[model samples]
Target: MSDSNSILFFVLGCIATLALIALIFKHRFFRQQKYLPKRVITPFERKMFLRLKEAFPQYHVLAQVAFSALITSEDYKIRQRFNRKVTDFVLLNASLDVIAIIELDDPSHIGKEQEDAQRDAMLHEAGYRVYRFTQIPTLAQLRKTISG
Candidate 1:
C-alpha cells in the first residue's frame, strides 16, 4: 500500500477506537443514572414553585413539574423508611442537601388541612422542611424564611 493509504487507515482506526470508547462511557453514564417513579405536581404546587424560585434566587433553578414532584436525586429518602419521592420543586444548594420542598395547596389541599399538616409534620419529622407558600409573600418574608 502507498504511504498515504497506510496513514489514512491508521487515522481511521484511531478514530474508530476513540468513538467506541466514547460510546462505552456514555452508555455507562446513562446506565448509572438510575430511574425512579415519576412525581406528579398539582397546579398549586406549580405556583408555589415559581414563587419559591423567584424568592430564593440563590437556591438553584426550579425543577420540572411532575405530578407533585420536581427534581429528585438518588440519595432522596422519606421518613428513613420510604424513598423521598416528591412532586413539585425540590430546590437544593451547592451542598446537594434539599433546601426546601415547595408545596402549593389548592382548594382541595387547603380543605384537607389536617392531611396537609400531617404531611408537613412527617417531612419535618424526617428532617426535611416543607415550604408551604400560598400567597407569594414579599421579598422580606422570603429573606426571613431563607435566612432563618
Candidate 2:
C-alpha cells in the first residue's frame, strides 16, 4: 500500500482499539451488581420497637433513624459531626412532630459514654428530648419519661 494509505489504516486501527477498551471498561465499572436483602432492625431492636409501639399506639415510633433526617445546621462542619450518625429510635406525636429521641444502650456503649453524651447534647441543643435506656422500661415508665 501507499505511505498515505498505510498511515490512514494505522490511525483507524488506533481508534478501533481505543473504542474497544472503553467499552470493556464501561461494562466492568458501570454494570449493575446484585445486593442481598437484610433485616433493617436487629432482634434486640425489634423487641424495643414492639414495646414502644405497644406503649404508644397513637404515636409513631421509627427505628434506625438517621441524625440528618432529624436535624440540620447552616454550618456544614457542625452538621457533618452528626450527619452520618444513626439513632435507635425517634418518637413522633400524632401531628408528625418529633417528640423525643430514644437510644437503647447495650454493652457496646460501655466505653462510649462521653461520645453518647456529646450526641445527646447536640440533640438537646436542637430542642429534642434525648432518652438513653440501658434496658427496656415498663409501660408506665415509658409514659412517665415521655410525658414529663
Best by TM-score: 2
Residues forming the 10-long window of minimal summed lDDT in candidate 1: 64-73
Which stretches in model 2 have alpha-carbon errors above 4 Å? 1-34
Tens digit of per-residue lDDT, candidate 2, span 108-136: 99999999999999899889999989998
lDDT for 121 (candidate 2): 90
Residue 63, candidate 1: alpha-carbon lDDT: 59
Query: Which pairs of residues have clashing backbones in candidate 2?
Result: none
Q: What's the lDDT for all of these models?
A: 0.64, 0.92
